[model samples]
Target: MQSLLKNECSVLVFTLSGLNETMENRYVLFSLTALYYPLIVFCNVTIITTILLHKKLHEPMYVFICNLCVNGLFGTSGFYPKFLYDLLSHDHVISYIGCLIQIFVIYSSILCDFSTLTVMAFDRYVAICRPLEYHSIMTNQTILKCILYCWLAPFFSMCLVISLLSRLTLCGSTIEKLYCEIWAVAKLSCFSTIVNNVFGYIVTLTFFGHAVLIFCSYIYLIRKCRKSIESRQKFMQTCVPHLFSLINVTAAFMFDILYSRYGSKNMLQGVRNFMALEFLLVPPILNPLIYGLNLTIVRQQVMRLLFSRNKCDE
Candidate 1:
């Protein structure tokens, strides 16, 4: 059994073949990434720093927004550095342990986005639907718990899936994407991956169900908003941004999930790669902009900080 186990587990480093066709454009890709990644960092970090520095913005809703941006930074840290290196280097490979770590960081961050959005949806529901109870309900302890839930649940789930993947005897060392992902690695297993498939489905449905609940909550909120102009204005200002974020993340994740499971091989590699990358690329940039533009207090503070800094410079 030991000898059989050793024989089956032969893979040491995974050669990422996703960059094979794109090598000719590596420099261009590298240049674009060099410019783009820091922008992602800039956007997310600015939002996070803005929220933290301002005392007035320390409320539950803004706190949650700050957490979302922080998760964006966490997710991209797993991919961007390695991806940039791969773009420069001739060989695109990652060690088994490195691959597992990448999968854990990126996917958990994505899941945490879902969890954060869900919690934010609930925050809005309470604020709009039950204004009198918002403070009592969304207390400091509740915020801390929600933050913990956002981080822990996905971490635990991905840790379980990675533990399962680690136990499997992999027969291949070539990953088809630029970055490591759970399903990509699981597909390389020599034995039946029934457990992995089952768990993947469970995780998908569980988070997607979070999306469902968010939608339902909005449905009721919108109905309530219709009766009062004040409520209608609040919904237009605050809830609309949340709704945009929810839709952005959902669509991006859906593209990734569907493409991973059922994507056509005939599709262009660039298209496939884009589908894989959309979640990481879009949301990090979009969420801050959405919130920054819409949320009155945050926008006021941001603009105030910017203009104040200009005065200092002048």
Candidate 2:
């Protein structure tokens, strides 16, 4: 009888220990998801709504901002709900198809974001550098074509990369992080990921390289504008928002590179968390604030919108 009781006690202890570990991991994931997702949703929604309703924000610049907000919304929506559920339910297993979908959404958003920013920089360059031809160069049809290309180019690129990535088979460790990021899941694949890694590097170089060039072009344009005192003040105000947006985009790319290169068993989990925050959380929060505070038109429109809403409530 004593031997039987001792065996039961051992079994219970082992089970409790396993449960404790699971609970601890779930707690950590839940905290992270809660911290980042709400802020992302709020900021994206604010930017989208503000641009859509405010007639004053119907210009090319705000149109690009609206596109960016939409991209952020889709990107966050793709991963955060499932991530939150996985954390709360302690079910970290994502199926192959699900993983592929997450990768598609993430990469598509990344591509669109970079492409949109490139177009925005080009728009700024044309407006400031070639003021005489700004209207002719940025006609509605031309802007529409640019936006379409930005959307379609990234969609196809991500689809191709994901198709290749999906061919690889994952064999071990069904439990991933709160969400199924491409590299995180790829690490568990039984097959070689050399092609995927190489393709990822290519994608990074293409998108981020273009972003850097666009940023430099804007800086050059700003330098030229600074010769005139009035134009310099206006240029600074306009450039500040773009600079903030560039920082957000660049930091996301840099962190992605770091995560891809050094993410192994030896890598610190905190580093991964930091990368996620920079990539997923910071931009959404910062973009609207940057635009709203720096752009006088947007601030006035936002105030008007709020006032109209308050009056309606009465």
Candidate 3:
């Protein structure tokens, strides 16, 4: 009881211990991070720039892909800059408000990815399953609404999460992740986190329902396309990449959640960090590359832009 009272819920700075046992390779880690973060930024920016400039690539599908890349950048920005800084410095601590902000940014971007992918699935459903009504259903106004849903839904979800977290009376200040995470911070609370856990599950189940809808839509699409060779070919060309991305993001999210909640200390620190980071590391780079290589229009425009630039240089 005395020790509990002494905890006081007054910690101003939260210490991160994810790297505490692995500081021997700080320089190598910093060097790799320094190189990798810029690569993520470059790839995402290229996609966004390509989409915005090319009138032909300005379709609803491509626009959603651009938004996914943008969200990737937003999510990485929340972690990489501060992570690189922490690698250089001996101390790794974040202010109370900074932790809240980081949680909001990172998680919201994740949820936004799901929302954007949901839109993409619907776009493909209309395009392949109901070809004639594609344009009428996926109008400029409809695209605008989809964009709003992608950004605004996640923003509102995170706002509620942050508000709830801010009210908690924390009993500790040590976080065991590479960056601020919602569950890690909530675990420090002195009081009952039943409400937080319930709301967190609600959010989890809601986004998961997004995944279920995407999966069901694909089932109908597969059945519909089975009748027509051209439709099958189109599904393979376009929908395959979206399927890959969905699987990739879903796996990463599962790893992070499972490891965060139930990870054993017997496991290697490096392995644990990888689980925590897989989502941020893989999806951001992989999504752009997958789409860029697989999509004929985007790839052709990219090559044209490159060849044109080469000719100019010569």
| Preferred candidate (lDDT higher): 1 or 2 | 1
TM-score of each: 0.97, 0.85, 0.96
lDDT by candidate, in order shown:
0.91, 0.71, 0.92
Q: What C-alpha lDDT, on a 0 to 100 scale, does residue 293 get in candidate 3?
A: 85
- Residue 219 shift from truth in candidate 3, angstroms: 0.9
Would you list the clashing residue pairs of candidate 2? none
For candidate 1, lDDT tens digit of each residue in 168-254? 888788888889988888888878999999998999899999999999999999999999998899899888999999999999999
Best-to-worst ranking by lDDT: 3, 1, 2
- Model 3 stretches astray by more than 4 angstroms: 1-9, 310-314
Per-candidate alpha-carbon RMSD to the true structure: 1.4, 8.1, 1.6
In candidate 1, position 310 carries an lDDT of: 95
- Candidate 1's C-alpha runs over 4 A off are 1-7
Candidate 2's clash total is 0
Cα shift from native, residue 238, model 3 (Å)? 1.0
TM-score of 2: 0.85
